[model samples]
Target: MISVGVDVGNKFTKAVVLKDGQVISKSIVLSGFDQKQSANEAYDQAIKEAGISKNDVNYVLATGAGKKEVDFANDVVSEVGAGARGAVYFFPSGRTIIDVGAEDGRASKCDQNGKIVDFAVNEKCAAGAGSFSESMARALEVPLEEIGPLALQSNNVIYMNAQCTVFAESEVVSLIHAKTSKADISKAVHDAIAARIISMARRVGVEKDLVMIGGVGNNVGFLKALGDGLEIEVLVPDKPEYVCAIGAALIAAERN
Candidate 1:
């Protein structure tokens, strides 16, 4: 039996195909202006990779901020639950999960089975979120892929104290005008975001084996800062961003 999971995130659309509880294939594509098209593209690519047909997929579970746009989905799961479930599926021992996505940031506490017991989320602003970081990369005239590594090279970073993305833009611009190094500025951005996520984790009683999930989890620089703040080793999945879609597919299998 095959199950499909689609995650329509703000920045991208991801899809995964599962056989039993294992992910056979997955794809991620930029969301573009047309979210529906993006979701379809992701689904198509995943099916191609899995060597399966649309009819072969027993169920399609949707998740993420824009799951409703995926017309083909059988059901939609909460992003919070999806992230927590995904993290635990990828790292079964993970007690805490910090998920930073394009639209928002979230923290969740889960049991041994990866079932979420509590969570917190910030949807009002982009501060400390993926979109904010992407915007910073644009303002700094650097690629998103380079921001993390360059951030690690900074000697000292000037803190971005504000949580508002608009205000942070003005602050970053002022820093640039003052000739602040890009490395330091990038480090500061990661630190600023880590602070926000840490608060959410602490409130939920962050435990050992904390894992960082979501697309933001791939940022090695951000993970370093988060580790320092939490004073613990952060467990990251081999394919961090794909975890949600993978989890959704696994959950879909249960229904089938």
Candidate 2:
């Protein structure tokens, strides 16, 4: 059976094609103003890349914040549910799934079968999510991709006191004016975000085989900070951001 999964996120759209429980193709694109349009484009791109006709797809499952916008989807799955299913695909032993998206973060507890048992989310604030780092990177006048390596060079421990994104941006600016090194400020930003996410995850009870899947999972600095905060080695899939889409596709395949 062949299936497709579309993850319509706040800032991006991801799609994956799954055939017989294996991923055949995946695509990612900026969400832009029209989420539905972006989702369709991502799906089309995935099918094209897989060298298959759209008519060959058995089912289409949608997940993420904008899942409802995917008008063509046969079914919808919650982000946490998708994350649990997706993380387990990469690490069969994964018991804790951490997902940090553009504007929110979620932690899901999963059983051996990748079914969600419990979950927690930090959706009301951006301080614990990917946006925090993007905003902080802007304040430091550094490219988002460069922040990771720069943060790894930090030699001093600097703590950020703000928990609100607006306040955090102000704090970052102040640090810039105070002659603080960019590396130290960057590390502080990642550490602060990591601390908030870790606290949220602990409430749901973190377990062994911790796995992280999201756009922020690709950030080396953030990953290091999160792993250190949890005092465990965090596992991230090769395509961390596409995990949700992969899970949705798997669900579609199962439904078939």
Candidate 3:
């Protein structure tokens, strides 16, 4: 039997196909407002890669903000559960997961077997997210990928007085005018993001083998900051951005 799981994250839709409890194929597809179309494309790509027909995918699970857009899904699940499951799958010793996406971030504590025991989330702020960094990059004329690596090279002062996204952007501009290198300003931005993620991690009580997932995990600077603030090394999945989809696939395996 084959099962398909897809995570419709704010910026991307990720799909994973599992056969007899092992992942056989996966796809990360760019998302659109008509979420259903994006989900279908994700599944199409997964099926094509697996050399299977749509009918061969016995069950489908969906999670994340745009999950409902997965018209063919058999179950619509919570992102927290998916993250927890995905974390344990990657690091069997994982006890905590900090997932930062485009609009929100959260922390979850799970048992050794990966069942969520407690969780905390921040849906009201965009301070420590991938979107915030992307916005800063665009305003600063710096590429997103270079934000972290370059930020590490700066020796200037860190400046971000407020955690609000609007205020932070304005502050970034002020720093720029003060002759601060984009790298320094970027590092401060990531420091702010790390603080937010650490705050969330503390809410759930930080634990060993901590896993960081979602789009933000792809940012080296932010992850490094997270590792620094939490005082516990964080484990990044081989595909940091696909942890949610991988977790969904694990859930599908459990169902079977």
TM-score of each: 0.95, 0.98, 0.96
Off by over 4 Å in 1: none
Model 1 Cα lDDT, one tens digit per residue, 55-91:
8889999998789999999999888777777888878
lDDT (Cα) of model 2:
0.92
Error of 3 at 170 (Å): 1.2
Displacement of residue 89 (Cα, Å) in model 1 is: 1.8
RMSD of each: 1.4, 0.9, 1.3
Residue by residue across 93-155, what tens digits does model 2's lDDT show?
999999999988999899987899999988788899999999999999999998978888985
- Rank order (by lDDT, best first): 2, 1, 3
Candidate 2 error regions (>4 Å)? none
The order of the candidates by TM-score, greatest first, is 2, 3, 1
Relative to the true structure, candidate 1 reaches a TM of 0.95
Cα displacement (angstroms), candidate 2, residue 63, comes to: 0.3
For model 3, the superposed segments whose C-alpha errors exceed 4 Å read: 155-159
Q: Poorest 10 consecutive residues of model 1 by lDDT?
A: 154-163
Q: Model 3, 98-161: lDDT tens per residue?
A: 9999888989999988899999988777887778888888778898888878767765557589
Q: Lowest summed lDDT over 10 consecutive residues: which window, candidate 2?
A: 148-157
Which numbered prediction scores highest in TM-score against the true structure? 2
